[model samples]
Target: MARIIHRLYNERAFRRERVIRDRSNPLDIYNDEELIERFRFCRRDLFELIEELTPDLEFVSDRNAALPPSLQLLIALRFYANGAFQNTVGDMVCVHRSTACRVIRRVSLALSRRLARYVHLPNEAEAAAMKQQFRQASGIHGIVGCIDGTHVQIQAPSENEYLYVNRKGYHSVNVQIACDANYKIINLVARWPGSTHDSRILRESALLQDFEEGRCNGLLLGDSGYPLKRWLMTPLVAPTTDQERRYNTIHSATRSVVERCIGVLKRRFYCLHGEMRMHPERVCTVIAACTVLHNICISKRIPLPRHHQPLPVPEEDVRPRPAVGIEDIAGRLVRAQIINQL
Candidate 1:
């Protein structure tokens, strides 16, 4: 039986002859040149953007001694691109794990500081442009931006699990973000306790501080979870009339930009989809870094899904309507609720 088996294996190998040929067309190898050219073009723009967004650190006297800023940017991009851990990034970048960690932190801080200038709430002119764009795209006017909060999972701490556990039954941090109709993040505030309500988180955030101080003239669109306030609007709880129902539908459709942004953000960074491996304190920093990168991608006009279009705005009656006093009441209630919760 052993002899038969050996003969059978030998016969199979003999039947399958290996072929080596030098006659293959050399032109096939040239096909990669076009790909290389495209890659170079992409790299050129990406590198320049990274250089502009990454601040020069004076802490290290010899810039040449440290990793190249391009390499540092590559590390951060890899984090968002692949959502890999430090060790994996180190392996791919050919650096030590500790070095990878340090590089990421350095690059994160540098980009966050530099990119903050570009990723802020829109000014009057910019807001006006966005309004006009919304009018053109969705036919709705007076729309500024959408606001919402999402929970990011974090590792549970042995000392205080309650502070980290959210309503979703996970250890997380509540992150509130505001995005324009274009889906570009305008404002972001992370570091709230997971147990905190969305309304409470918004009340305590600096994102709302401008609106509170009457510095912002644009309105913020939100869901029912957010308390109503001047410069901030929420959908009506129940639509009693056709106009109210239509308004609520429009509100939901347009307000979906924030939710879409959050979804895209989570889909891009797998680490954010579930519990992060890092400590809780570091989670906020990571989140901020991710958001800054998100804004950077947006500024570059990276292609996204077509569903990301702003919700269509319905035509309104030209007649003047009575001013609703709900904004003040909502603001007061939100402030009081936040204080009580704290």
Candidate 2:
């Protein structure tokens, strides 16, 4: 009887010890000295966002490696940072392939939910403040924000070839974004089919609906690909010999803010530059998370590349009247004037 009791006690002690050891160990994945250090810095934003949004989410142990919440987040950011495959991530983190996938998916969902709070469309007061800032920065009065769509490459799905194929002959996802005059992302809409026209997507987006209902007041600057609307502005299409060329030049210069913003985003996050290998549904989530990350980095005053200097305007020269009818010229002038008023 004494021997049996001793054996039972030893077994219980052994199980408790094993549990304690498991709880304390973290799985280290990457040995890249710089990456490890950088990942440590990246955790703060994710941690704060998660804590603020989901106060109840806690790090719990599973049968596989019991990853801490912070470490789990680190894994996702690391995935974005390097754009590596799951097998590669598993090798780096010292986990199995399945474990790496699970970690990434869990972290992605958590971050997406937490980060959504930060990317909402601005209210009236907030929109007014943004307008004032834009007026001050760009000297463009009555400007609320700029809107544009960019294509992100993705792996082609065998089932829906046309839906995913873009004009560029690649599988892509269209991400439409709205930014304040100060070039901060105010809102993002990412669910449109890749082949959808930018103008059509904008019409269907909440931004257009809100503006139409007078819930929001701001003009979105867009390229000619978008239709001309009272709430949206596009540059005057070239209609004459000299004026047409000048308008084109000016339009390209002014519309460059959105282009620069997109460039900076893709440059900073290498994962976005190439085709995203993840499922189609997750593409939107990844884009949103990256935008949120961009905002966080901006708020933290992360250094970004300086805006390119605008090209010098060409010398004005009087040109002979075009053979086109006077009615055409007058119509073009009217359209240009309407755009200017907006």
Candidate 3:
């Protein structure tokens, strides 16, 4: 009886200590500047966001002490900023490798769910503002967003491995993004396999449907890889006149913002630049989470890291598709009209 009581008393003391330690940890050890350098957010903001994410990241209050939410956020941020191996991040955060993996996955999923509100395309009025901004920046009229596709490398899957292998002979996901004039991503689609063509992905998206139904306004400027439509504009394949040539030049300059956005995204979240070891579905979740964080940085006016350079995108073979509707013809006429004006 005495031994059992002693054991129970010890257990209670341990639990009390752990609860106090967890509560006091973030406050005592990490200052605001240290938090910013490590997690890329001010300490107060990080703590508040972690508090909000508690419902998703919190584990059952079992006998074992669970890791604190702030610590989990720190692990996720470090992984995102450095793209380090799971064990490496574990060492930095003083957790087991498997625990670090769980923390990252859970935190990323929670962020993607709660933070997606900031990453969407603007509404009608906001889009008008976006168009005015683009026009002022590049003298391009009615341009809502710039569209492009990039390959995010991933490990070869056990099933459907060939489908993920891109034209560059590597496993990847062909991520499509549409960005505004300020280099913020307005739309993103990342589930497609690397082997999927850029044009097919855009054609199959809900954004295309919205544009076709006239629910959305403004045209998306894309490179030659995208199909020209009433709502989506591409540079002329072969410019025969000076007007067409001038149009292409302006189109290239304005559309390049999407490329820069992608570059900044990869630079900010090094995980995208590195070969993601997670499954494709998990990778998509991570991508979504990173995009949300990227928008947050833009909203807060966080300065980008120096020496971050945009990489060159490969010019893929243009795949022509049959345009059956009046929309295509109308788009061609608009292009011609714009060229004539130029």
Model 1 spans > 4 angstroms off? 1-41, 53-66, 136-140, 304-342
lDDT per residue for candidate 1 within 1-342, as digits (tens), equals 999999999999889664322222212322433312212114545557556754563344554345556666666556654557787876654666777788767766766665477668888998898788655644456567888888887778775789888876888888888998777888888888788777777777777798878676667777767767856767666457666666666666777778888776765554577667776667777788777766765777654333333223334323333223335776545433422332
Against the true structure, whose lDDT is highest? 3
Model 2 pairs in collision: 29-92, 29-93
Per-residue alpha-carbon lDDT of candidate 2 for residues 1-342, written as tens digits (9 for 90 to 100)? 999999999998777442222221122433434433334223344556555534333455464446656555555666765577877766654565676788777666665774556676678887888768666654455567777788888888666768988766888888888776445687788776688778778767777778778788766667766666666656654446565555455545555666777766676565777888877778778887778777776666554433323223333223421221122343345446643543
Instruction: Provide the clashing-pair count of each candidate structure.
Output: 0, 2, 0
For residues 1-342, what per-residue lDDT tens digits would candidate 3 score against the true structure?
999999999998778452212223444577766655556667666766788888888778834668877778888888997799999987775677888899999999998895448777789898999989988877768889999988999999888999999888999999999989887888888899999988888888877887889877898998777777877877887788888999988887788788888988888888899899989999998998889888887887765544544556434345543333334777888888777877
Decide which is better by TM-score, 1 or 2: 2
lDDT of 1 at 104: 69
Question: How does model 3 fare in lDDT?
Answer: 0.81
Candidate 1 residue pairs in clash (backbone atoms < 3 Å): none
